[model samples]
Target: MIQQSLVLTGKQKLAWLENEVRDLKDDELLICTIAGAISIGAELPQYNETDVTDCNPVYPRETGYESYGQIIRMGKEVTGFAEGDRVLAFYGHKNLGVVKANKTVKVPDDVEYRYALLNTLSCDAAKGVLKLQPQRDDKVLVTGAGTIGLLTVHFLKNYMNVKHIDVLEPNDKRRELAHELGASHTYSKKEQISSTYYDYGLECSASKDAFHSVLNSMKHHGEVCILSDGNKDLFYLTEDFYEKELKIVASSDGWDYQKHSQWFFKETVKVPQLSKIFEAEITSDQLIHCFEELSESHNKPLKVLVRYL
Candidate 1:
């Protein structure tokens, strides 16, 4: 079948190109339409074609991941899932494709496809939250109010039940959204935090500066969990690091599927507002224009869902 997929050929421009896909294998499942995420400004560093060298710095020449789709066809070996089942997978932004059965998880019938598309991110946030292990009364500061940051805030408040939650975000829209998501206080920057110290800090901004800000705000022997991935190097003064006896840890995409499933089910019930963060939904045909619009918009979109149908 002829399938359309969105490929990032340049820095921020996406091309909706068509290609042919083969039939599903016995151990594979055929996915129909789904939603995927764009990592243009996050993982992909902006650069001109003139800068290309033997380095080939870009790890993924084509970008896009985090997809959830309906199972149009299932292989004979697939036991848990059937045809027409809604499943979430680590697939790209392709309109149709075959994915190994083990890599896909069936989404609950009650959950929306957009919300299911966030399965990977939600899992990542849950893993980070689990690692932080914040106490109920701890004053927790979450840096960055982006999707992951806000999701971390939601999990901290709802899942962990951490009462004193604060968020630091430069964007006004995101800061406000953080407030609505259960942050007790919100600041435009770390310097604006009224509290002198926090028991724990969840650094989600992926900015080296933000990481340092959180580290500086930590109390003696305080813990800070780094959640975002960035290219910049982080440096801390020897005196400050020793004086505070700070502990820092990093969390990333590796999440146990069983734990993720449990967290997803529980958190989704407690925080239905989690799905509200997605601001825009565009079809595959509008992929290029959507990225352009998002690149130009100053307000900053929280989560933009690319729909394929």
Candidate 2:
């Protein structure tokens, strides 16, 4: 079978290419995509061809990690999921794809497809929050107001019950949105932060300066979790690190998707603001033009959602 796939052939290039769909393995499930989201933090570098992580980055890279759909078929050996089960998987922008059954989590009947699409990112935020172990009285600081950063704020304030959470972001619109999503204070500049103020911090901006600002804002012996991809700007330990004796830890993917999804589905009802992150929507066919717009400097959406169905 031939399936259409969204691929990046080169820097700032996107194409809907055709690919052969091989037979599924015994433990795999075939999914018909409903919707997916562009991970701006991770994909922007690949789109711009400015990824600093690789001296000579490879081209024709498959882009996307947040997609969910209904299972159209299951391998003979697959268990615990039916043909029509709604599931979220790490499959990219392809409309049809196969994934291991263990890699997917069933979407609840009540959860909307848009909300289910955010399962991966929500779990990413939850992982960091759990690692930080924030308390109700503890003041928190989060860098960046992008999707991951904003989601980090949501988890810290709503789920973890952190009383005070400040955000660092330069964009006025994003800062305003951050305030609406429970950020107590928002700063456009690092100089505005008070020294030794926050008990815990999370770096989600993927900027070295933002990381430095996080370290500067921390109280003595403060702990911070770095959640940014950090491929765009490299992070370096600052003087505050040695002076204040801060502790820094980093979290990437979620520890348990199935377990986290069960809790996330029930708890998301309380966080209606999650919808704000995915305000921009486009059809799968418009992806090429969407990437062109995203390549321009001024194009910024909290998150761009692609509807396949």
Q: How high is the lDDT of residue 203 in model 1?
A: 83
Report clash pairs, candidate 2. Answer: none
lDDT of all predictions, in order shown?
Answer: 0.74, 0.87
Per-residue lDDT tens digits of candidate 2, residues 194-300?
A: 98899999999989999999999999999999998878887889999999999999998986889888877886787777788886899998888887887785758
Give one digit per residue, the lDDT tens place, for model 1 in 144-243. 8888898788778877889999998998878888888899989886678743389898888767677777877888898888887654334444454577
Taking all chains together, each candidate's TM-score versus the true structure is: 0.87, 0.96
Query: What value does the lDDT take at residue 150 in candidate 2?
Result: 87
Instruction: Show the lowest summed lDDT stretch of 10 residues, model 2.
Output: 49-58
Instruction: Give candidate 2's TM-score.
Output: 0.96
Top model number, TM-score: 2
lDDT of 1: 0.74
The C-alpha local distance difference test score for the whole of candidate 2 amounts to 0.87
